[model samples]
Target: MTFTGGNPQEEPPRRVAKKSKKRFLWLALVTLLALIAVVLSVLYDRGEFDGLRRRLLYTKAQKDENGCAQLYRYASDQSGSFASLDGSLVSVSMHQVSVLDETGKTVYEQTVKFQSPALVRGAFRAAAYDVGGTSVYVLTAKGLACQVDTSGEILAVALNKDGYLTVTSNESGCKAAVRVYDASGQPVFAYRSADRFIMTAALSDDSRTLAAVTMGQSSGVFTSYVVFYRINSESALTTTALTGSLIYDLIPMGSRFCAVMEEQLCFLDDSGEVRAAYSCGSDYLRRVDCGDGYAALLLGRYRNGTQHRLVTVDSDGQVMASLDVDGEVLSMSAAGRYIAVLFSDRMVIYDKTLAECARLDAVSEARQVLMRADGSAVLAGSTAASLYLP
Candidate 1:
């Protein structure tokens, strides 16, 4: 009442206050919009907006009887060792690894040798297979592992399959013992572990990083700890522990995610943190693989009972899809756009969505199914092995 004219200073203060509130409101709105943008980006990156396509089906032709008969008759032939088998080329070994086209014509052949005597011994015990590419990995006895190229040269040699190797050409000058090699057989980077023995070792599809399990060894027992390492451009290394358990299997889900099986199924991040754990109902889990953002768990009973269950989950431990089968899944493989599920007498092909797309009656029990990156499959059993083209 006393200041009827309204003080000029008071007016200025009021104006400043109003302007400040307005500015804050605008800032808050911008922040909210930025948060929404980030969320949308994440969802898009996770493939949440992708549309589902219809599951396609294909008729099964009796596995080319002539081809099967040829492979069967040649299984024991010393001249028939596999150099490569995928797509249009099937390479067998006689004097050297021989490359052949689908029509049984020679394409390429080369002479390669094992690096170390230990490696050579391991090579003989290895189950060698080709990925339809220039690289080949040998899973050896004593758990020694190595990869070679088309030239049949040793690229990288791991003392044990659990990711320890010697890096040849890094800045560290082979001082860094835990190293990984590229497809060209060059030691690009190195890693270090806390434990001397590794229980499991899994290489990513890109081969940039390796997931491994180190174990504390006793007289006869071992306690396992899982870890991962990144191979960087500087040839330097960084490692992180993922979990502690008696790991039975480790499967990489891209470079950042991995499925680790101990007593329970656990999903781990690149840093080895457990993102999720699933209590596998069965006592024995034979194999596990992931694709299309889903994991396929193969469980078996001692009496030959088997089941195939597919679980799709996100990084947050949320289940997106679950598929179950009544029959025993004898063997399985996944690559590219398909998952090949091998049962006792039938071969079922499912898309990434876990929906059955194709079925074929097999001649005998399926022991192993090898899914190639090129969309072909090789089904090997106790009695027979046949290749399938999709």
Candidate 2:
């Protein structure tokens, strides 16, 4: 004798319908995100997505001795400092910092001056600290720093795409302190190194963590330590000893940090724990760039022979790609999820997945190289800056 309720017969179908609705909603959400991604990619190629342009034009041409049009009339003699800031070309002059738009229009200009109280230190000479935004920060040769507008006196600065700014200033007694600021330039957190000499530091993308490498010497032996701190808090999160090596650079990649040492390349999480590491036993670490969930290392050994290796790793610290490079690597730039290695006579571009994208032969020998995040590049030779968009 079973008594079935009126709605009991409809229960299974109702549950199935609810599950179908949830599945439909999830599919719709995913589809929307996919569409957005596709749109952004398209815009990125068009150069409109990031205030850039679809076409890249060099400066005006002047007739040279060989009757070849010289492009030097528009470029700069100062190629030591160059950066792409908010789709603009930023070059530093000994007297000022100039920003030029994609079409080659000067948008913003800041001049260095011999102001009071330090007239003997000379005017500001800028080398780009970090670009890729509307405004940049420049560190002068005389230990003076500015926010590239009117802000001043920053000893060091670290910024991420999330608009989190971590700036360090020189404190009393050979110490430095860090201050975390929001996008609007409001102070969100402050940290003092207290007694340690802050060597290299970076701010996590989420702005919730700060990683710094500091060193101390005792008994004529130096030991280095990598410390991680929670933002806006007095307590540190973790301290990891970089034993047996000296860290030369600290790079922040998303949520992790890369401690690039003399012969070791190590990745650490926000907790200061090593997740992945690569040690070049006989080779020397030349350069390391970590961004966009990828880390590219340039290792070379010139003592015994000319041996160079380009190694790329993922965020998980797994080696994604490795290649043997020839000759002296003049510079390496990591942007747009791609890595560009510039030799004197040639330059190669590799995509984020560690696949080769394009290789271009140097025309006049690459004195300086710059690349957009998407693999487009400007190779500045002695005469002109050749733009390559691939």
Candidate 3:
């Protein structure tokens, strides 16, 4: 009768109030921390801790004294699917193809608007190479190759020199062929194989040797054979098999060759003879460039990992130097005195001594790095491409 029990409703109200207060206090503390973070970020952006932040950012650009390298923003009008740099010129292709000079000015622009033959109705692939700084070799689909000047005019279609156009298509099961034409588009030599497929082909620098990878099949197993041939004429040549079992990459290293086959790094001579073979111990070899009497092999792990290794080897299969790198080495190009390595986020330029010359954040997703004959570097990225001059 005399209120032996407390007021239940009043006690419930006090408990609810205490919980609300605790939540409010927690939220207030979080808001204060966020405010402090914003303030710190603003200060950092305003150069309050610029030096410290730069160290953490690993910006080697500021340390470059000779300014032998620079970073430039390379934006393409279209999404770039392929990029190549030769000398101070950068070539990019996506919906169309264009060439940009060292000053970021368009030297040539051409829309790839050619219709393929009915027999070769597939997506076309293109590659551009600088012939002499004035002319470019444009290799396109259906064996349509052309040489264009810097002004975007066709100089020669279906080049007929000693080294002309050769195309290999897998349209027919394991049927491979090579068609050579003269500068006037006249067919000089044509060879077709009924047994195997020709995957790819490359000509030597001297234009006397022709290297190709041939695909062979037996009992559902796939194998590749590299054939080195003496290019006597477009029509008359002899090919000798070098190696078998899936040739992944073939690069002509001056008088010799370097290739990756089934995770093995192998070197071959001009006569299709194996010089040396070494286990790469990785899934794939990304790129190989020859310079300073050595080949720089960029090897990468297959899965998501940051471990990358750059190995330098002499022409005779001697290991010169090896360096562990941080990111995936995307592409590499070398010239007389420098080598430019393109990583995912950065571009490193090194001298013949393997000393770091300059490090720069890539303007975009770098797809290719080219060290020009003039000691400059060109970078081709996703959205843009740039040239770095010394």
Candidate 4:
């Protein structure tokens, strides 16, 4: 009765209650949102979520835990030759080499009117060389630049991080010559061989030592040799003979050399002495790749056996792991401690001990694959290129 508007006191209580309810709801909502955010962060750390929101919510593509944020569809059905240098993708097609970054954006592109097959690698930023020809081109911010082409056809080439290069060339049927060059296109050293075919070579980090694997006829029979040279002195350091095998590739690991042979994996020191060796019995070694202080060998069966195997080896020539799969390996790549092997219909990624980290299903047959240091892979299929992040 004392109120002027029938119940001024009652109106204050009702208004107070309503305001209290609104405040409670606001506090509860904030608490719930914060709790949800914390739970999601924990799950992501445990890989339970693998940051799926990054792929689903973000506008720009980013690599998720599944390692899939990039893809490319080739204009042609042909599979291409490629290599990784500086995390850039250098792919070779019919008459062109395309360089792309991790985002699938084409950074640089080059065409060859000469119509010869090409090879590309990430060395000195990026480089592309003609396979089975004499032309070698290195690309930089300036443009497509050619290395000093010497006499004879260029058979093999290797480049270091500092742009130091090693080229193997043959003159007719006589012999092969191995030469090392600095970044300025000046020859560091040249080693000549008579009656020996220099198949391939590798340069060390300091560009001090050059390793070459050559094959020659000894007593009317084929014999392979692992040779080392001191680039500064232009003098031969060591030459070791290998029997009953053919050397296919030479790779540098730290201060040692890994010689990939047909039936064996041999390690040689800087002096070219065989430090360790692993034999494959009758199995034929298909390919050997070194990364993350390890070497991986792709082995085929003996005398037309069906199943194939992959052997993970350490720098000390220790057999760390072996995985046998039932198909021909279409392509393989290794980075850091990860090894990626692609079959016709699927791909498998393994760690240093050859444990299965991930198995990616493929829609079509993959022709080749490129792996990254973070256990991600890019599989080049006939129709498209798929990036697998894990």
The global C-alpha lDDT for each of the candidates, from Candidate 1 onward, is 0.48, 0.62, 0.54, 0.72
Candidate 3 — worst ten consecutive residues by lDDT sum?
114-123
All candidates: CA RMSD in angstroms?
12.7, 9.4, 24.8, 11.3
Better of 1 and 4 by lDDT: 4
List candidate 1 stretches off by more than 4 Å: 1-74, 77-100, 106-177, 192-195, 203-208, 217-223, 233-244, 281-283, 301-304, 307-320, 326-328, 365-367, 372-376, 380-390
Among these predicted structures, which one has the highest TM-score? 4
Which model scores highest in lDDT? Answer: 4
In model 3, which regions exceed 4 Å deviation?
1-78, 81-88, 103-105, 113-165, 170-174, 181-188, 217-222, 233-245, 282-284, 362-367
* Model 4 score (lDDT): 0.72
Model 3 C-alpha lDDT per residue in residues 1-390, reported as the tens digit of each score: 554357866557767899999999999999999999998888654434433543443334433443333343444543344433332243443334455543445655665432221111011223443211233344432232565333222211122123344444333332655544433334444455667666665555444666677776656666666666666644424344544467755656666666656566677777777778666774456676666457777776665576777777776777766777787666787765567888778888775556676787733555777665345566665565545544
TM-score of each: 0.55, 0.71, 0.61, 0.77
Candidate 2 similarity to native, TM-score:
0.71
Q: Which window of 10 residues has the lowest lDDT sum in candidate 1? A: 49-58
lDDT string for model 1 (1-390, tens) is 354557876667777899999999999999999999998777544433221111121122243632231132123322233312332223233223333343434444444432222211011222333322234444321221345444322223332123333221112222212455543346666454432544445555455566665556445555555556666644323344434456665655554455555546666766566777676555456666555456655655443555445654443445555577667665676655457777777777676666665566743744666554334466654433456543
Q: How many clashes show up per model?
A: 2, 2, 6, 3
TM-score of 3: 0.61
Two-way TM-score contest, 1 vs 2, winner? 2
Q: Which stretches of candidate 4 lie over 4 Å from their true place?
A: 1-59, 62-67, 77-79, 113-126, 139-146, 171-174, 219-221, 363-365
Of 3 and 4, which scores higher on lDDT? 4
State the lDDT at 59 in candidate 2.
28
